[model samples]
Target: MPQFSLYEEEYHPSPLKRTWIEFRNSHIAVVGLVVLAGLLLFSLFAPFLAPYDPLAQNIDGLLIPPSWTVNGSISHLFGTDALGRDVFSRIIYGCRVTLGSSILLVLLAMLIGVTIGTVAGVMQGVRSSVINHLLDALMAIPTLLIAIIIVAIVGTGLVNSMWAITLALIPQFIHHTRSFVRAEMKKEYILASRLDGATNRQLFFNSILPNMIEMLVVQGTLALSIAVIDISALGFLNLGAQPPLPELGAILADGLDVAYLAPWNVALPGLTIFVMVLAINIVGDGLRSALRKRLVR
Candidate 1:
C-alpha cells in the first residue's frame, strides 16, 4: 500500500494554468496566439521598431513602390504613400493606436456592462425586464451603425470614436452578463450559499462571478475584435483618428484616394486589419472551447 505523508505535495495547477494548457492543445489556437502575440509586441515596440516617423513626409519619395518593385529603394521597405510617409512605419504605428485603443474600450465596456448586469440579475423583477428590453432595443441596431450615430453626435476624433464604440459595445456585454448571471443564480450552489448566509454581494464575488468568469472572458475577447473593426470603420469614415495619427483605418482611407498610384498604401493597412481581426476571433474561439471543455470536466 502506498503511504500518504502529511508533507507530500500535490502538483495541482491553477485554473489559469490549466486553461492555458488546454488552449495550447489546439493547433489553430497556438497559431492564433503566436500571430496575436507578434502583433501585440510589434505595437508595444512601435517607437523602437518603426524605421521612420509615421507622419514625416519625404517629398522625394512620393508614391514609391515596394522595395522589391522596379525604381523602389531599399530605405522604404513598404514604399511611400501619396504624402511620402513611409507605409511600413505608418502601419506599425497604426497597429499600436488601433489595438491599444480597442482593448481599452472593450475593457471599459465590460466593466460597466458587468456591474449593471449583475445588479439587474440580483434584483430580478420589473427592473430586470426593463433592462433587458432596453438592451434588446439597442442591440437591434448594428454595432457599427450605433457607433457611427454616436460619433456623429459627439463629433469626430479618435477619443470620441473610442467612447462611442464603448457605449455601442456595452449593450451586448450587459445582455450576455445578465443572462449568464441569471442562469447561474438558478443553480443549487447559489441556494446553498444563500442558506449559509451569503449576501448578494458575497454570493456574486465568491461564487457566481467565479463560475461565470470564463464565459465573460470569452465574451470580452470577442468584443475586442468588434471594437477593433468599429474603430477602424470610424477612422475610415473620417470620424476617428485624424491627420498624422497613423491609424490603420485612416491610412486605408488615405490610400484609397491615390490607390491607382500607390497600391501598397491601401493593401498593407487593409491586410493588417484583416489579420488582426482574424487572429482575435481565432483566439476568442479557442478560449471559448477551452473554457467549455474545462467546465465539462
Candidate 2:
C-alpha cells in the first residue's frame, strides 16, 4: 500500500454553535448583549448596589434633583422622588419587577402555545383547521386590547395583569409554532421519514422538533419584547404592579405628577424602558439573521 499521511478529520460545529458564532460576529448584537447583561446584573444585585431603600421615605430630600444638578446631592445620585425615595434605587429594583415578570409571562405562554400548536399541526384534519381558525380569530384582536379586557374582568393587580398578558400572548405563539410545524411536515424529509415507517410521534419529536428550535428562539425573543411592553403599559394604567412595588411603569406614573419640578423622574424611567425594548429588538434581529444564515448553510 502506498504511504499516506494520516491527519485528524475536520470538525464541524453543530447548528446551535454555528448560530452563536454568527450572532457574535454582528457588532450591533454584541452591543445589545452587553447592555442587556448589564441591566440583568443591576437588577440581580439591586439589594447591594442600591444606595438607599427603594421605598424608604426621606421627607427632607423631597423633589431633589440628580447629583449633577445645582440643587442635587451625592447621597441620592439620581435624586429623590416626591415621596423622598431614591430614584436610582427604585429604578434598580424596578428592573426586577418589570423585566423579571415579563420573562416568566413569556415562558408560560410559550409552553401552552407550543404544546397546543404541535398537536394541531400533527393532526392535520378538521380538528387542526378548527384550532387554527380559533387562533386566527383570537389573533385578529390586538394583544394589548385583549390583555386590557382580561384585566378588566379579572380585576386590577400585578399578578392578574401578568396572567392577562400571558393569555393574550398565547394566540401569537400558537399561530407561529403551528405554521412552522405544518411547513416542516410538508418537507421531503418528513415524507421520506413517513415512507420509512416512522411513527408520527417519532417524526415529530425527533425530526420536526429539532428543526423548529431556531424559529422558536427567534419567536421567544420577540415575545419577550412584547411582554415587557405590555407589562409596563398595564403597570402604568394601575392594572399591574401597585404602590411600593418599585415597578418601572408605576414609577413613570408617579413621575408624571412632578414632571414640571423634576423632569429626570419621568425621563429616566422612560429612557430605561426604551433602552430595554431597543436592546431586546436588536438581539432578536441578530438571532433571526444568524439563524437564517445557519439554515442556508
Candidate 3:
C-alpha cells in the first residue's frame, strides 16, 4: 500500500483501446495494403516495365523451356508459349488488361447503381417496392450467364465487355445502397435534422448520404473482387478480351496444353488474379470492421 505501483499506469492500458489500436496497426491489413499498391503500380507501368513485347514471337524459340542457353543467354525466363512469345512478359502485361477493364466496369456500375439506389432509398412505398423487385430479378440471374448472353448479343470488344460487366454489377450496388440509405433515414439524427426544417434534398445530401459514405467505401472494395472474377471468367470463355490482347484468362487457356511441362506461364497470371482478388477482399473486410468501430466510437 505504501509503495503505489507507479508502473501500473504504463502497464494497464484498457484492453478495448489496445484492441482497437491493434486492429488499426494489424500486420495483415498493412500487408494487404502494400500488395494492392504494388499490383496497381505494376499494372500501370507494365508497358515500360515489361522486358519484351507480350505478343512478339520467335518461332525458333518455340516451346523452349526455361534454362540458361549454353551461349550465356536465355530465351525466356518464364519459358515460351506455344507461339514462342515470352510468357513472363505476357503475364506482366496481362495484369494491365485484366485489372484496367474490370475497374472501369465496376466504377461505371457504381456510379449508375449508387445514383439510382440513393434516389430510391430516399423515396418509399410503391417506388421502393418496384425498384427492389427489379433489382431482385436481376440478381437472381447468374452473373456469368448474363455476361455470356450480353457478349453474344453485343459482340466482344473491350468497350462491350466493360459494358456487360457493368450491367451485371449494377444490381448488387443498387440493392445494397438502397437498403443502407433507407435504414439510415429512420435514425434519430435524420428525424431531428428534418424537424429543423431541413429540405428533403438537404436532409438526403447532408445528413443521410454523408453517414452512408463509409459503407459505400467498403462496398466498392468488395465489388472490385467480384468484377475481377467476372471478367476472368468471361475472358476464359472467349466472351471478353479478344485475341492479340494479353488477358489473364486467355493466357491460362493457352497454357493448359503444357501447364505441367512449363507451369509458370499459366501460374503467373492466375496467381496475379487470385492474389489481387484476395487482397481486395481482405482490405474490404478490414475497412468494414474499422468503419463499424468508428461508428460505435
Give the count of colliding residue pairs in each prediction.
Answer: 0, 0, 0
Model 3 lDDT per residue over 1-297, tens place: 588775756455454454356456767876887898887887899988788899998888776666553422264676777888887788787888888777788888888988888899888899889989998999999776777789889998666777888888888888998998888888998899888999878987888777666767788888888888888877777778876788888887778888886676677778888998998888888777766665565
Model 2 clash tally? 0
lDDT of 2 by residue, 237-282 (tens): 8888889789999999989999998999999998999999999999
The candidate maximizing lDDT is: 1
TM-score of 1: 0.94
Per-residue lDDT for 184 in model 1?
A: 84
Give the alpha carbon lDDT tens digit for every residue of 76-122 in model 1: 99999997999999999999999999999999999999998888877
**lDDT: which is higher, 1 or 2?**
1
Relative to the true structure, how large is the alpha-carbon lDDT of every model?
A: 0.92, 0.91, 0.80
Question: Worst ten-residue run, lDDT, model 3?
Answer: 66-75
Q: Clashing pairs in model 2?
A: none
Candidate 3 Cα errors over 4 Å, as ranges: 1-24, 67-75
